[model samples]
Target: MLGAGLAHAATPEAYDPWPGLVQDIFKSRPIHDGSGVIAIEMPYRAEDAAIVPVTLRSKLAPDDGRRMLSITIVIDQNPAPMAARFELGPDANVMEISTRVRVNNYTDVHAVAELSDGQLYVAKTYVKASGGCSAPAARNADEARGRLGQMRYRQFKRPGAAGGAREAQIMIGHPNNSGLQMDQITQLYIPAFFVNELRLWQDDSLLLAIEGGISLSEDPNIRFTYASNGAKRFRAEAKDTGGHTFRNEWKIDDPGM
Candidate 1:
């Protein structure tokens, strides 16, 4: 619930936003500590506020018996606090996810995991970055316009991954402009134009699906590790706020395990 009334004028160190966030985002549901469920990796001080790297790792063992249904990332003080919600494929066995997000202020980034057993687990980490949501796009207008909707996919064989575990990355070219950013030439706010939905598949089965928001940085590259199902094809489909749809497919080469 980054829409309204969550804004605070108090210094980042003096104010707390987690309690209110729990109510608006989770409907007052109980959130347990996620130490045993998941872990969040981020820089203590990001070199660039506009593109801060964050990785979410599942902590459950292979024999844990419970699956991670989905995970939500929240940049508590960002203009749009809820950055993204990723739903994992039941059969993919996704263990890790990495992506970039904008950090508008020095704030606590929370990763809430919803488990198959109907429990919400929360993990927190502090990040020191500012002015991200309103930061100008890295590329010039012309350059950005040229690459709109371009998508790329790559798969990497994990050295010792069991059951054909593999690492893959998907990159989509889009400006992902937040409505808060000002256009240097026009001196007016840029209209929000970003990829709001992304879905990945291995052949006919879902691998992952993401519901995104303005807090996600431009370009939106997502890298993840999953147990490959010996499916011969990988596919991706993305949709933006402007209603443009981008789709791509690639052949999944055998890792020769």
Candidate 2:
């Protein structure tokens, strides 16, 4: 969420946010076209503006020798365009990442990848959505409050995958309020309160970490593909804007089998 405050709404025909976004978010760093190095998958038209699915996939060869350091997701038309930044752990070998986001307007969504070699690559996709940032919470206040800070994790085998490839999902229970929505009863803007930081680890080794902001959907679910490191345990820790920290760990049924 580095460029959170710099975003402004712009129509697809009247403006392009990528150039300014590059300067603001990347400090005018050169952004190479990510035609082959990375790709973004998203719907041209979102059925639900508040929970539009987006996925980032890495196309680097295993022997490429340059690991993906981090990826920044930016939705140009959102009030806070910098949705999330994901830092990949060196040993994780994460190949794919999927998450839900709030799209405030019909805009171009950009994914910028910083590789170990100190170069930045970018890919873009356009989405047709509106009013997502100010959309009402998915759950009512009472129910949302009850599930706050709760977390869940699930692992799945990657079909025809090699090199110990696996897919996993992590979900956190949160309202992730954007502060832009008006309370139906009170008619007041809800203060922005969301899980701003999250980290995942396999035993002592780190897997991934996310710096998030108001542009993400409620509940913040993330599904990713990574290579197993033979670690016996999986752990997650999340911190919200309210300063509450939620931590959990699970023992792997089979370590490196």
How accurate locally, in lDDT, is each candidate? 0.93, 0.92
**lDDT of each residue in 1-257, candidate 2, tens digit only:** 53554444332357777789888989999999988788999999999999999999999987798889999999999998999999998999999999999999999999999998899999999999999999999899999999998999999876678787888899999999998998999999999999999999999899999999999899999999888888899999999999999999998887654
Compute the lDDT of residue 253 as modeled in candidate 2: 88
**lDDT against true structure, model 1:** 0.93
- What's the C-alpha lDDT at position 135 in model 1? 95
Off by over 4 Å in 2: 1-13
- Looking at model 1, which ten-residue stretch has the lowest summed lDDT? 2-11
Q: Provide TM-scores for the models.
A: 0.93, 0.93
Clashing pairs in 1: none
Write the residue-wise lDDT of candidate 1 on 111-203 in tens digits.
Answer: 999999999999999999999999999999899989999999998868877767889999999999999999999999999999999999999
Runs in model 1 with CA error above 4 Å?
Answer: 1-13, 255-257
